[model samples]
Target chain A: MTADDPVRDSLERFIGKPMGEGAVAPEEVNLPMIRHWVDALDDRNPIYLDEAVAAETRMGGVVAPPAMLQTWTMPSPVIAGIAERGGAPTAMKSENVVTALDAAGYVGTLATNSELEFERYLRVGDRLKTTSALESISPRKRTGLGLGYFVTWITTYWAGEDEIVGRQLFRIFKFDPSTMGGAA
Target chain B: MSAGTIHVGDELPVFELPVTSTVIVAGAIASRDFMPAHHDSEYARGQGAPDMFMNILTTNGYVSKFITDWAGPEAMVKKIAIRLGGPAIPGQPLRFSGQVIAAEDKNDERVFEVTIRAANDLGDHATGTVVVSLPLEPSS
Candidate 1:
């Protein structure tokens, strides 16, 4: 897709736009959620579960995994319901770009890459907030999946007021999966 | 795990994850990723995916868990950068492995950079780097 493409034009309007007004986590960093995550992954880390072990360590207390940064700020189901019910404005999200592309015949999407940088580990009780901005939208390119464009966004996770705990550079491809048959 | 003992070529411990459909769906929900492609097998197949695949959020959690499992709980992750190449499909076990590429002494702590990869039969599912800081041992 090029600048001349209507779908591309719609997506271009989102470039540099912040995702949502500012996403504040509905819950604070806590052990229950962290436990759920570790359990799901079957992670047997003593510091994450055993308080005594954590006390002996330098961290002095249990801390949420840095990778959980995005989890804390994920859009809650209630919030999604509100948006679906038209009770709230559509938050600035990359999904909007996908919806626009889907309407233009690009119905398939897949995450291609992600880069995360964490400044520090998040401790229990800490709250998180996130803001994302569309970084770039690539021109149409051929790939194993099909003809598509790559959309990139930068999301920063914040703790408390101003401290940036982590940042994720995420990219996904919007494409026509049917074209895969012709790809090598 | 002492940071001082790590070397540039040292290999991180390998981990195997037995992926299951239930786990895939549960992980998606836990991560608040309600994407149909991650839970509904039919929806995934419709999208040309073999079956419901692991979402990036779940992949990120697994990657971090693998690193911390080797680095020990005391070690704090400073960064992780990953690129997804293949779909982590259910019924295929995902194997995770890594090697220490660099280690440095920063202030009173030791930091190690590990190059890591997660793979399945299809090929590398994800590859990335993680920077972790190991606490300094108390002076005796």
Candidate 2:
């Protein structure tokens, strides 16, 4: 398919009615769980590893940070080189999105920022579910690469009770990387 | 805007979610936010961010839903404004805080004027104000 394909066609079948959500079981909030995440981010914050300091804080323990949801839900690297699984290659974080674009039948694109909201906490061991939907899909004035963009509403739930923990609204653009600043 | 609906000091829903590298990496990859600070810690530090910073936009979405998610599905989000401060480092507990400061009825819709904030063990990370429309129809 050429770079000039319609962006609406560049999405995966998952884009239909396209409401998505996931539920994860609750787990105990522990130090090890907290430490690994901090270590992964290379954070030296004493709260993650230092119990003494943790007791002094309002949390009463080495509780995870407020925006710690990212530490818990990341993609596995097991499927490293499936072009069809993800399009942009291993190096590009935008790979699967790029892949989704290809599945949608469009090429060369970028993910644009819009807005987000933080609502709850996810301590270690807190099982949760995340759900998302196609909030809106409107045509932008044709840019250099594709015709328009698609935006979605992604939300995560903590444990079983809370209605929401966080929300993310993002947009993806389908275009020709070669024609623009282009290419990772 | 009516002050009775939401007092000036009422807090919005700002979540104190965990900040972890796994979610950082996964979320970064999922959103295709390829910034190094997100994927590589050593490189991220070298670049001057405090470990992996949660993508700001994603942070906003997460917190926004903390409120609207409960408010309902038909509630239309009119607008949201955010200011990012410290890097949302992994490990730190992030508190997503939002409060309704004002409210008004326009064209048959109850428009909530709210202020949102995200704080960590250290201090505030992000803050913003939002205007959202609640469903005219009552919840089931």
Best-fitting candidate, scored by lDDT? 1
**Tens-digit per-residue lDDT, A85-133, candidate 1:** 3222234354566667777777777778899888877888889998888
Per-residue lDDT tens digits for candidate 2, residues A1-184, read: 2255355444433343334324343344456655544454444544456767655543345545444554344333333443333322233433344345555545644445444454534455665556655555544335555444554545444555766666656565655434444432
Give lDDT tens digits, candidate 2, residues B1-140.
22234455676544457878876776555443455656667766654456867765356446545655434433445556565566678899788777777777776567787777778876777777777665343332
Question: Considering summed lDDT, which 10 consecutive residues are worst modelled in model 2 chain B?
Answer: B1-10
True contacts kept of each: 0.57, 0.02
TM-score of each: 0.87, 0.46
**Model 2 DockQ vs. reference:** 0.06
Which lDDT tens digits does candidate 1 get at residues B102-127?
A: 88888888889899999999999999
Best by TM-score: 1
